[model samples]
Target: MPTASGSRARGASDEEPLRPAFDGPLARRPAALVARLRQRAVPSHWSSWSGVVSFGCLLVLVVTGLLLALLYDPSGALVRYGGSYSLLRGVEMSRAFASTLHLSFDVSGGLLLRQAHHWAALVLPASLILQLATTFFTGAFRRPRQWSWVLLVGVLGLALVSGWSGYALPDDTLSGTGLRIVQGVTLGLPLVGTGLSWLLFGGELPGTVIPRLYVLHLAAPVLLVLLVVARARSALRHGPVQFPGPGRTEDDVVGFPAWPTAAVRAAGLLVSTVGLLVLMGATLVVSPVWRYGPSSPGHAFAGSQPDWYTAFLDGALRLVPPGWEVVWLGRTWTLAVLVPLAVIGTSSLVLASYPFLESRVTGDRRDHRLLDRPRDVPTRTALGVAGVTVYVVLWAAGSADLVATQFRVSFEGVIWTLRAALLVGPLVAGLVTRQVCATLRAADRDRVDHGVESGRILRSPDGGYEEPRDALGAAQRWTLTRAAAPAARPSPPGSGADARRG
Candidate 1:
């Protein structure tokens, strides 16, 4: 393990040297672009496809979002419906709500694009999450790529905010309820709560929230594009991480060229993703705003929920005990809102700082290009499993009422059970997952060391039949051995000064 200075000194050895393929004239030349891009190589792995798919989803969202924006009106003015949908033909509603209805039923192919846009939005966060999980489990955030992880975390945060704000754009009863929840949550902060709420709504609940949220939803993509570009530049500088395999070196990546083959393949993936979104949009219904009607404080829908990405917060709120508020020094404090906010904020901080934290804890500062198998990093893998379990559990808790009703159980009992699960689930998951990883690693080691039975019957001197065993081939043995191998230790600096302690 090396200190920060030592890591910096050896940085050049850690990353593959890459040419600036798109600089100067090549970047501006449309004719030679395809050929030039094809010269850059990417890792030939299924995980690499995740980035391509995510980018495709981004394009789908942008195109569909632009179309939807053309017909959207973000005003709070109430208007009688004059378009299709006979049920609400003359019902009065806000212009924002009415515009969504018009887009859904009146405009040609409008509903398809709108629904596709939504489904793509949902897929965007999910894909980013998958990519992040892959990066984390593989320890791809080490050394030169640390900042790249930060940029990715930023992108994911913005995507969540964008999704939440976009989900609130329709101004239906469900959306309005979500907005109210946001307002209350914001207002529960200690000192800045009131001012934050004022800025968010521009006055009070149902005030300028719609127009403000519309701007935020639109602005998120522009920021996302910028951050993604930054992340790409950083990644190129560090080169793509590769898996350990035969004839593979730490100095370079082994994969296909990015231009002709990868570009065409990525394009095909994009087209397929868009086509699937279209199929889902046309054949399935989602977010039926017409059925929910326009936003009204007095009219509460029987069941309401935010999009799946934001449901964890809803779950946290539901799990909080009633009468959890506190009053001190002439001020009221609401733990119901504060607890969820704290959990989310703390979790974000931990995730954003994870790379540096791992480096400090492990005392290893060497640059790495080969990804570690999850089973080889038991502690980190277990932590990842535990975190994911908590997230899924919280998401389920968001629908506690439904669970209670469906199972014919006491709602209070369900809430209490969830609270208990929240406290105990992660500990169990972490320990169990760590043991599982250790066991799997031991099995892999055994397979590599002792080999497998070839199932051939052999007659011994005692007339006993036995199956013959075959050792793993050189390639298979090398692969498993390299995968199970520990990360290389950094050489001590001059004088062996215990730089880490210093």
Candidate 2:
């Protein structure tokens, strides 16, 4: 019943047609949205940078690995090497080894890429470990972030597998020795031993192992990429955990945002990591295949050792007592191999499930966005130290032969000593670490309840002298008192109350 102009006016007045709800931030005032995103907070702690370092190392590994994969052959078929390296002029080696030599000397910057790849592989695991350690110590693996911890553990396991597979791909003497050891271990299993060995090797000791390892080497990174992406998404969903401090709480994070601040810092870290790796590659030598020559079944040299990251497992194998086979149900059981595998597997399982286990034990179902100080959780900190002690002792045991030779000690004595330490060291470390953490917690309690001593003596009118004290700032007070541990009861020695009582 309205006129056309009136109708138009009525339509115009009907709230401007909604515009599809802006289709997310992109369709909105994108500039403003971006500004808001840039203002988002991240944790400013140094430990927070560990994730950045790990991701950067992973990127470097991928780039260098892709470049190296272009030229390196994976065939185990023997061929005569005719490369420019004078030492190995006419040596018969696997096609894999020949191609490795060709890539090292014939291809431009091949050695650099190889070395960089190796270095990045090494650094990736180290950075991941650092991330895990920081997350564990800070109690950041609670509640919603539990799966994030599991993903990290999976990534680390894959990294180790990828590294060991790559090591076997070079087909050098050292790598062949490693492969031989792997074969022996695989064949030591009970029922599935032969099947897995045949599946892996395709025949006997070095039979087509290089190609299979190449497949694993390639596939591992792809899986790693998937897991890393998943972990990042999970982290984004859960948000970053922050250390407890003034105005910081479980409800919010306190630091730089992702857009320009965290992004710029992460970019800088990536550049520095890549540059350092390149520099090391240019100057240092790693896994020189030409020097080691082609692998033969009987060509293992004494003093050859696996990479540092795998040293713990190697050390575990070394620490096992020999002649540990048992005849059970008419089948010989290799207890030496089985025992280490069982122990390591159990330890890894414990580590991966620790957050859930702790939560279950403590009945703490609440979400945690604020991190705990190590001293605030003495038992947990002690357990972590104990685990680390076990790993260190085992790692040291890997180089038992070298230690014996270098330090002028008996090999048997060195092995026995490490075995004893492996049993006793963790207990000692746990006790000491727990006592230290308790002492620190008590100190924190004292600092929070009573001000710190200013070291200035003030004489009361009654002629008794007392040291003045300075009250902590709000931030310091919050940091000291934010921990969940209950405060100590007695006043600390030399405190104002204790001085007055004295």
Candidate 3:
């Protein structure tokens, strides 16, 4: 052999240098993964962004809520407030109210954070409602997505509870009135009403309800996050539902990729949402507890109204006729409370089970990956509109007092009008919406059968005026022609298909 050092160098050169993991195939693997992620298609439609907006609001709520929770005192004990605001100075109030006043006046950025939390709470429910509507109109709840719909409805219910609990945490006059209403509603339950009320309040009206609510309020978010994550994962597993278009099939997805396109858009949306909430907080004053003094069972502020999300329940209660109570089984039954409870509960049950109901009626069990245009399903569209009309009527009824005062109208007259609307509005809306949907579907079919009018008038050889038409593009034509065909009614038992199969 040559020299030992020369032999070692030769061996190393011949075997090739040992490469580190970061420099080997693994190095290119991450890049390849990133590239693949960048190319993964995401739905870019405006309607697809509603869930993102809701999630953005939820994030804002969590952040601001945590910040506020650090300084909040959720106690119902009596305390004397001697804060910066002169109006409520030396006033006897709950610890909750005193801390609220202190946060508003003493702590830096506390009020802004509190208002941001409030605004985010308001926006979260609205966004969830919008998302639910979009899902309903598009038939996204069909087949495998039915569970997702149920999850979304559950999330919405949790949000409503969380908002109501947070609203009560301030222990102000308005919120106190809301809590009293809750206590009454709880106590209105049949047989077990008193026990339930005691369990909830821990004894009496303001006993330990605030502490109980605080626990519930915190627990709601945790459950919400878990449900949301589950919903998101389910959506990813099922893939996104896309609108009908050329080159798009039930099995195909067409949109921008997830990495840069969706990532950038979502980031932009989150920033914009946060900025808007902050601006609202800085400029608008919401729930001024100082003006309301503090919680007291005997006192309630005039013109007080619950937040919009809970307004329907308030309106429902207001709309019930007086003396709607009955004696049954040697106990009193308050139909005023029971009626609204039954109506709202039944409506929610119907809504949550609608997908299955439609499936059974239609008898079409195929997986639906492409969304149905609202016009393609006239009856469903009409039903959704009708339900919305009912909700709007209820929501408006909640502000009946304000409407009466503002317009110099009769309070009873407003109540009566809303009551009538509660009965008649949905029917009218359903009929009109169905007609409109039918008309739109007809127009779409016409557009498909006949090319679009080009508005170009020309003189024919015989000197008659003629208008040229332009053919629709492949995507436009497909969109117009892809409406769901009407389902054939089932043949009578043992009549046609069943007999043939038999």
TM-score on alpha carbons, each prediction: 0.89, 0.89, 0.90
Which of candidates 1 and 2 reaches a greater lDDT?
2
Q: List CA RMSD, all candidates.
A: 9.7, 7.9, 8.5
CA lDDT, every model vs. true structure: 0.83, 0.85, 0.85
The TM-score measured for candidate 2 stands at 0.89
**Ranked candidates (TM-score, high to low):** 3, 2, 1
lDDT of 1 at 388: 92
- Report the poorest 10 consecutive residues by lDDT, candidate 2: 493-502
lDDT ranking, best first? 3, 2, 1
Tell me which of candidates 2 and 3 scores higher on TM-score.
3
- Per-residue error at 201 for model 2, in Å? 1.0
Across 1-502, the per-residue lDDT of candidate 2 in tens digits comes to: 5555225643456565565755876675776767666667766678988887788788878888888888989999988888899899898999999998888999999989989888888888899989889899889999999999999999999999999999889899998988888899999999999999999999897888889989999999899889999999998888888777655656656677766777788889878888898898899999887778899998896888899999999999999999899999999999999999999999999999999999999999999887888988888999999999999999999899999999999999999999999999999999999999989878877887788999999999999999977888666775675574323312212211100100
Candidate 2 pairs with clashing backbones: none
lDDT of 1 by residue, 1-502 (tens): 5455224554556665575867677565874766555556677677767887778778888999888999999988888988879988898889999999889988999889888888988989999999999999989999979999999999999999889989989999998888888888888888999899989898887888889999999899999989999998998778778777654556645666776666787788878987888898898888889889889877766657678888888998989887799998898888888888889889989999999999999998888887888888899999999899889889988899889888999999999999988899999999999999989989888887779889888999999998877998766677687776545423212221111100
